[model samples]
Target: MEVTSPPPSLLLSDSDLEDCYDIIDPPLTTSNDGSTVSEDIHKSMDEFDRLINLDRARRKMALLNEETEKEEEKK
Candidate 1:
C-alpha cells in the first residue's frame, strides 16, 4: 500500500506535512504535563478562539499521524 499525507484540513499551522510523517506528539494523559499553559492570554471568546482552533487542530493532526503510522507499519 502507498502512504499518503493527511488531508489539508487535518493539518496544524505550525506543522508541515512531512513533520507529521516523522514525529507524532506523545499521547495526552488524563493530566497533560501537570501544568497550566499560556494562561492569562485570553479574557474572552473573541480572543480565545484562536487557541481553541489550535488545540483542535493539534488533536486532529495527532490522530491522523497515528493512523498513518499504523498503515505504514502494516505495509
Candidate 2:
C-alpha cells in the first residue's frame, strides 16, 4: 500500500486564512511593569498604529476631496 497527500488547493479554507491572519496580526497589549514590552505585543501595537495612520489618511483625503468639490462649485 502507498500513502498519498492531498493537493495544496484542497488543504486550506477561509477559516484557515483567517486563523493565519490572526496569528500574524494579533491584538495589542500594554505592559503593566512599565519596563519592557514583549516582542509579539510590540508587533501587534505596530500593526495597530499602521492601521490607525492609514485610516486617518483616508479620512483626510476624503475631506480634501470634499473641499476641492466645494471650491469648484464656487467657480
Candidate 3:
C-alpha cells in the first residue's frame, strides 16, 4: 500500500505556525537564572565579534588571492 503526503495547508496548524515563529523570534529576557544573564550576553557578544572578524579576514584573503591570480595570468 502507498500513502500520500498531506497538503501544505493542512501540514501546519495556526498554533503550530505560532510556535515556529516563537522559536524563530523569541522575546528577549533581561534576567532569567540570576546574574548569569549578563555573563551569557557577554560571551555571545564576544563570539559574534570573533565570527565577524574572521569573516572580514577571509574576504581580505580571497581578494588578495584573486589579485595574485590576475597578476600571474598577465605574466
Global lDDT of each candidate: 0.68, 0.83, 0.85
Global Cα lDDT for candidate 3? 0.85
Off by over 4 Å in 3: 1-35
lDDT of 1 by residue, 1-75 (tens): 999999988867755755774467542333354432223233355468978999999999999999999999999
Residue lDDT tens for model 3, 1-75: 999998887798889989998799764556655545556789899999999999999999999999999999999
Question: Comparing candidate 1 with candidate 2, which one achieves the higher lDDT?
Answer: 2
Among these predictions, the greatest lDDT belongs to 3
Distance from true location, Cα of 11 in model 3, Å: 64
Could you tell me which residue pairs clash in candidate 1?
A: none
Most TM-score-accurate candidate? 3
- What is the TM-score of each predicted model, taking all chains together? 0.41, 0.50, 0.54
As a TM-score, model 3 comes out at 0.54
Ranking by lDDT: 3, 2, 1
Residues 39-71 of candidate 2: C-alpha lDDT, one tens digit per residue: 667678999999999999999999999999999
Measured with C-alpha atoms, the lDDT of residue 41 in candidate 3 is 85
